[model samples]
Target: MRLRIKREDLSAIERHSKQSFPLECCGLLVGRRTGTEFEVLEAVPAENVKRSPTLFEMDPQFVHAVLSRAESRGLTIVGFYHSHPGVGAYVSGKDAEFLKLWPGVAWLIISATRELIEERRAYVYEGDEIRELKIEVY
Candidate 1:
């Protein structure tokens, strides 16, 4: 599968990830999906209710608002994103557990070190497996 995101949106993720250093940053990916391609038109950064270095939980109200707004703009909440401060852009066991709940939603993982974004990876869970998705910046 393919995930396409705007350059500005990618930069926004980097900036948010950097600013939330030491604490994982979480957000939603707003856009549309066509066949095998998921195109992200916006990055809706949400408050990390958990506010922990290793964990992140998006505020429920914030998620609802974003989802509602995206729908109004003819967009869908196709996926979610989060930062992994000081770690590799790979899914951890905890993330896997969360993935089970999201099923087909795309998971965007950003790795940052000391306020600088190092890498960005995307994945999708299917049939009890986590598979990486190709990213295309536009």
Candidate 2:
């Protein structure tokens, strides 16, 4: 299965990525599944620990509020997103391990550096394995 991200959603991700340069930024992917399609509803930025490479903590309050809003809008938390400063856009082993427990969600990774804002990539957790996802940003 594949996911389709609207243009506005891509814009939001880009904006957040630029705003949080030097430090990682995190957010939630709010959307609903229709038949085989996953339509993104919105991209909600969540608070993340500043300059912490070993840890990523999405603010509980922000998460709660976004989930609440998604529930009200008949949507759900489809996945999570984070940037990889200098590293390329690929799921790390740690990321695969973390996603093992939540196998149904998508993992979006963005790589931003001095040269360019790299393209985003998606992944899925199947058991302890991390599989690359085909993502189309529109």
Candidate 3:
């Protein structure tokens, strides 16, 4: 599977990651699924209730609001994105635990250092395995 995101949208997510430096930032990936690819339309930032450097928990109320907004606009919550400040862009054990709950959802992991983003990678958790998904930013 593949995921495509606009350059501007990538920038937005990166900026959010930078702004939330030292703590993990998270948000929803709102867009449409096309063929074998997920085209991201927006990166909707959400408040990380955990607000911890190594963990992220989206606010329940904020998530509900985002879901309602997406449904109203005919957009699907295809996946989600989060930043791992000062860490590699790899799915961690905690991430896998959460990813498994959403079997077909795509996950975008952004690795950031200080105020700069180092890498961004996509993945999907299916059948108890976390597999990498090709990410095309254009």
The TM-scores, one per candidate, come to 0.94, 0.87, 0.94
Off by over 4 Å in 1: none
lDDT of 3 by residue, 54-131 (tens): 999988888888878888999889899999999999889998898899888899999996668899999988767888
Candidate 3 to truth, TM: 0.94
Q: Using alpha carbons, what is the TM-score of model 1? A: 0.94
Q: How high is the CA lDDT of each candidate model?
A: 0.91, 0.77, 0.90
Q: Once model 3 is optimally superposed onto the true structure by TM-score, how far is the C-alpha of residue 117 displaced, in angstroms?
A: 1.5
Residue 116's C-alpha lDDT in candidate 3?
82
| Residue range with the least summed lDDT across 10 consecutive positions in model 1 | 112-121
For residues 6-26, write the lDDT of model 1, one tens digit per residue: 999999999999999989999
Evaluation by TM-score, superior candidate among 1 and 2: 1
The candidate that achieves the highest lDDT relative to the unseen native structure = 1
- Give candidate 3's error at residue 9 in angstroms: 0.8
- Candidate 2, residues 61-121: lDDT per residue as tens digits? 7888989989998899888888877778877777777688778788888887544588788
Runs in model 2 deviating more than 4 A are none
Predicted structure 2: lDDT: 0.77
Worst 10-residue lDDT window, candidate 3: 124-133
Compared with the true structure, model 2 gives a TM-score of 0.87
Error of 2 at 89 (Å): 1.0
